[model samples]
Every structure is written in structure tokens, then in C-alpha cells.
Target: MNKKIEKCAILMVSTDLTQKQIAEELNVSVQTIINWKKKDEFIEFKDDYQRKYLNNLAAKAIRTMDKLLTSDSDQVRYNAAKDILDRTGYKPTEKQNINMSGSLANPYEALTTEQLLKLAGDDDG
Candidate 1:
């Protein structure tokens, strides 16, 4: 909770500097940084900072994906559109795989004629 530990946690979250580097920058020994990092308050602050940082990064990535939807390359546009859809809970429906305890006399009995054709990838039902 001290100003020094707070600064250390902020540096640790905001930059790619190692603890030793941060200690040198802050005019403290690496041992001090390591010790402060192990404290409960330091841990809590660092975890919250990291979580917020990641959330911001994810937002940026989503924005980038949205921008990529207008790209000239068809493949890039398609992939970005798919990524956005997948992230926004618009994923393509997938057939469920059901397991039965025992074999049935006719496995296709439960399926309609159209359903059977669709499952077989048939041209006509």
C-alpha cells in the first residue's frame, strides 16, 4: 500500500521491464522488488491491473477485426468477419453427436426422410 510498492506494481503492469530493471529504475534492489511483489496488497493490485490490461487489449483486437472486414483481400475480409461472428456468439450450428447404450433395430427410424438425405449429403430427399 506504500507509494513505492504501488509504483512498482504499476510499472510491472504497464511495462515489459523485469523486476530487476524496475528496481534499478526506481533506485531499489531487486530483492526489495521481489519482496514487495509477494505481499498481498501488491498481488491484488497487480492482478487487477493485468486483468484490466487484457480486457483493453481484447477490445482493441475486436476493433481491429471489425476494421479488417473491409479489407481488399477476400480471404482476409472473410476470416475477420468469421472471427467477429464467432466472438459475438454467431457461430455456425454444429450437429450433436449422440451416443446410445445399445444398438437399435433401425438407427434411421427416428430421422425423417429429409433429415436422412441431409445427413447423407444427398442432392434429393
Candidate 2:
């Protein structure tokens, strides 16, 4: 592969720069970068770069979480445990169900002006 394309792939995964920024850094037009993205080889390289980059990031995060879990500070350990649980889909959240049947018109239209004002955090007086 060309050095420019290799550099572009590296810049893409290793930094948060936009295509325009990368183009500017590489002294190429944004369209040229867009064209590179459409090419099969460039697409494959970018996909590989992104996959490896994300894997490395996940590994680092896991290592950090492990360290935090073993921390002497109760708050740190608790936070780490909560984060792990949240990421693993073990955290509990309130579920709300709304009845949207044809028989049920907009609830807002049924409310009294005072009730609407109260709901809006304005005094009803």
C-alpha cells in the first residue's frame, strides 16, 4: 500500500480528527479522502485498524476496572462495581409504559390550564 494511504489509516483510528482535518494534515482534498474511503483496500485497512484500536481500548478499560475493583477506597470500589454492572446490562432502570390507543387522545389536551401550569413548574395562581 502507499505510504499516504497507510498514514491516513493510522491517523483515522489513532485520533479523533475528522476527514477534513485529516485531509488538511495530509495536504489532500476532502474529496480525495472520501474517495479513499470508497476504495476496497482502504476500506479493509480502515476496518482492520478500527477493530484493533477498539480491542486495545477495551483491554485497557478492563485492566483499569480490575484495578479499581481492588482499590482500598470504598467509594472507588463501589463506583467500579457499579460501572461494571451497568456496562454488563445488570443495572436496574425504571420502565414506563404509555397507552397510545386510538381511544386515548393527547393527554395534554385534557389537562386544565391550572394543571398544565403546575406540570410546567409555573404557579397556578
Candidate 3:
């Protein structure tokens, strides 16, 4: 909420300036920026500013991607096409890796409640 911290957050997200550079610009020590970076206020402000900045650029980015589709390089065109397809929900199907750590087969499939509890070392009945 303070002007200094708000300005710091804007600079952090909207520019490629390093923390040292931001500290220099703000007339603060690098350690000050480093300290501020760990604060919730700084993190929230930077994230909010970044979201707003990207949202504002979305249309321009789309236009650039569309233009790139006709680029002279085949790879560039293919990449642009692929990006557009991905954004439009035409992404390739991904193979999911199922991790079954318990057993190769259903370890307790043949067990009754009493037997399963016994296997689990919960035979308190």
C-alpha cells in the first residue's frame, strides 16, 4: 500500500531490472529489496501486476502469433501453428504414468474386512 513498495512491485514485474538495479532506482540498498522480496505484500503485488500486464498484452500476443504463422522459416511457422493449436485446445494427448506402489496385483482383493485389518496390523477386535 505504501508508494515505495507499490512502485517496487511494478518495476519488479514490468521490467527486466535486477533487484540491485531496482534498489538503485529506488535509492535503497540491495538488502532492502531482498528483504522486501520476502514479504507477502511484495509477492502479491508483483503477481497482481504481472497478471494485469500479461492480460493487457494478450491480444497483441495473439496477433503476433497469427503473424508468425506466415513466417519465412518453416520452423517458425510450425511453432506458431503449434502454439495456436495448443491454446485452442488441440494439444496432443499425453500418456499418463500410473504409479502403483502398493502391489503388482490387488494385494487385498481376496481379503475380507477382518483379514485386511489383520494385514494392516490393526487386529484390535
Candidate 1 clashing pairs, residues 3+ apart or interchain: none
Best by TM-score: 3
Tens digit of lDDT per residue, candidate 3, span 1-125? 77888889999888999988988899999888888889998899889999999999999999999899999999999999998999899989875544477435554678899998898899894
CA deviation > 4 Å runs, candidate 3:
92-125
TM-score of each: 0.66, 0.57, 0.67
Model 1 scores a TM of 0.66
Give per-residue lDDT, candidate 2, residue 82. Answer: 95
Tens-digit lDDT track of model 2 for 1-125: 87788789999889999999999999999999888888999989989988988988998999999999999999999999999999999977755445666353465987888989999999944
Which candidate achieves the best lDDT against the true structure?
2
Cα displacement (angstroms), candidate 3, residue 119, comes to 23
What overall lDDT, based on C-alpha atoms, would model 3 receive against the true structure?
0.87
- Better candidate by lDDT, 2 or 3: 2
Candidate 1 residue lDDT tens string, 1-125: 78888889889888999988999989999999888878999999889988988888987887888889999999999999888788789989875555585443565889988898899999575
